[model samples]
Target: MRLNFSIKTKIILMNMGILIPIIIFIYVTITNNLYSNVIKSNIDLLTKESYNTQVYISNYIEKDKGVDIETNFVHKAPLINTYLSKKLNYRIQIYDKNGDIMTDSVANRVTLFDKDITNAIKGNKAYVVKKIDGNIYILFSSPIYLKDATLGCVRYIYTLDIEEKFINNMFIIMGILAFMSILISWLLSKLLSEKIVGPIKKLKTVSQKVTKGEYDNRIKIRSGDEIEDLAETFNVMSESIKDYVESLKEERQKQKKFLDNVTHEFKTPLTAIIGYSEIIPKLKKQSDIDESLVFVKEEGIRLLKLVEELLDLSKLGKSEFKIDRKKNNLKEIIEEVLIIINPRLKKYEIEIIKDLCDIEVLIDKDKIKQVILNVLDNAIKYSECTNINIKLQIENEKVILNIIDDGIGIAKENISRLFEPTYRVNNLNSINNNGNGLGLCICKEIMKKQNGDIKIKSNLQEGTSIEIIFEGN
Candidate 1:
């Protein structure tokens, strides 16, 4: 099984992992040093007192000439030790060369010589710690030398009550301090973890919301760090996904409508052709039969044209439909399109106005020409205008071609869907145009492939304007 831990918990654990050992080590080190110093201080005091006693004895022997150390020292030992013990606040003992206790300040008859006494009698100083009656004590021993003669040893037995209490109190304080440090570390780690993980939690929440199709949710963080950058990027991703989903939904609606329109367009022509063919055989008059044949032929032609336009639209929508782009004079291409569309213009009694600019650009000549032709044809067929204006110019480092008509124009609401496949504005001019709605759609796809775009502006009964933009030279 996996162990699950929040960032906050991990941070606290890591801090404890580092601090606990250090606190323990510091406590141990400090207490150990303090105890050692206390013991050394007591040993040094005893050595100084032992030296003073040795000097006092040597002076007394010199003052009382002809007096031996054993007789004189033994005679003054009790009084001297009593005074030394009263001054030093320690239990004092004097031992002979044989390690026999000669005198005791505490008046107890103790005969056995311990390690400290034995070492002192060997003409060396020594100290040892011992537990007496559950109380700690330091036994310090020093040798007394009288004019290069080893006279005896003086031992000081000092109670370590004060030092032991001080050490114990220090340990308690350190323990409390360690606890406080741990507490502080936990608090700091918790705060720091919250600072880091707070934004991440918001991101996770927003992500969950986005998964449920709530794309408007966003993270608001301003830590001035990578987390802030991540939040910003996450918000952008949410917006993009929202836009893409909406576009997909819109495209799906358009597809459904396109299918409906295609079915209706096909059905109308097929119904007319089928009705005319069936009725022609039953007609009695030759003139009626001829008219019926004409209707069938016309419907057949319209059906064939619709099929061809649908095929063109399909090809344009595919990835394999590549355009051959080359440098060409845009003015010449526009004039060529006008030449092709002139017959229809004459048929409709429509006058054309041209204001062309000689601009060179990289484009697929055939595709660009076809786009111009489609727009002009739509204006001529649907706009019902007498004058169609064609203009080419450069704007903002881009070549722009505009075709405007002074005829009954499209409604504002219908302009947005003009490039969608098989979308037709339900107006009188649009109904009577008899042009497949895929023309403009194909024009749009071609422009897109050419790294250009098409835009339209229209007002009811005023006119329509088509703007085609291409990358400039």
Candidate 2:
């Protein structure tokens, strides 16, 4: 099983791992050393002051030099107690050389012997004790000197409750500071994580888009750091992908064009062979040898023409048909086409109506002628009517050639596919004699090669018109 942790939780854990120990160490150090130092400094100051006061009183008493020890000392001790008590709010005790307290400031009576005072008297230093009365005190005893000899001891007692309060307050302040520091550190970690991870999240999403073939998408980070360099690289990759896609598209188009042209070229010769074979049996049944010979000759010539067209189409498909293009008279070329197609016109009883206007174009003449012949031959084969109209006009610096035929026209559904290889219009009348369904396809390819286009308009059972437009020089 995997344990899941939220981002915030993980960040908090990491911060705690790093900073919690440091905080603990700092807090411990502050509470122990800092508190001890503060209490020690205060206690030292108070101890020194208490010792000085004791010495001051001891010096005055020893310097008095009075002969009456009991009466004079009693009277003077009360005065000293009253004066010291009014000045210092601490309990002061005067001890004799034998470690018995002689005077007490609080009660103005003889003091009791205590262990802390005895220790202080023996060492001439301060001593600390916690009494059974639940009070902690520091006791300091200084010797009373009389001409460089110890006479007695003055002991001062100070309570430790005030220092304990000071230590408690310091602890509270440190605890509060620790809490604030942790809060601030947590917020800073959160903000820093968001700033760093936000761009990473965006980059992940954009990377997913790129995986899904959206090469146009890009990450737009302006961090001016390594992430910015990554964004620039991503943009460059998108551009490279776009270029590769375009190249693939161009390659596919070229492949389709090649297949279309090759299939069209093969169909023309196959159609010629089939047409001549169909005519052979009929010619054999004729009794007139001359007419039979003439029919055979005609079929043979048609086969030859088909073969030549196939060879030319094959060369062009391979990109080997080198063109020496120059300006040509459009009128003269149309007349030449009329001469070549005259035989078919007579056989089909088709009348040609020409509406030629003065036009000149720069193109490969032979290829243009082939394109026109293919279209006209298709019209003659599919159109059962006797009239075919050819028109040439100039418009917008273009040469437009329209071939209209009164045939069983193409169906609307098939018009779009007419230029696809082997896509025959489903015409029942000319199904057997439809030649190859490649003429229009070849014409379209040739037009495309010359930077021209062919458009068609037709209605079923009415007529068909094909418009070939070429850019004019």
**TM-score for each predicted model, relative to the true structure:** 0.39, 0.37
Model 1 residue 233 CA deviation in Å = 25
Give lDDT tens digits, candidate 2, residues 1-473.
99987555676779977888898898788778965785577578767776676566656666667654334444566667667767888787777667766678877543545665665556465555445367556665666544545546666776778777877887888789888988988888887766556666677688889888899898899887777888888889888988998999987886665555455443433443454455546554555445444544554565566566555554545675444467888778778666556556766788999898768788777667767777777777776767889999888888899989988887788788877665655554762444455677667767877778999999888988989999877
Question: Which one is best on TM-score?
Answer: 1
Best by lDDT: 1
Report lDDT per candidate.
0.79, 0.70
Which runs of model 2 end up more than 4 angstroms from their true locations?
1-322, 431-435
Model 1: per-residue Cα lDDT over 316-376, one tens digit each: 5677767789999999988766654454566678898989878999999867866776787
Give me the overall lDDT of model 2: 0.70
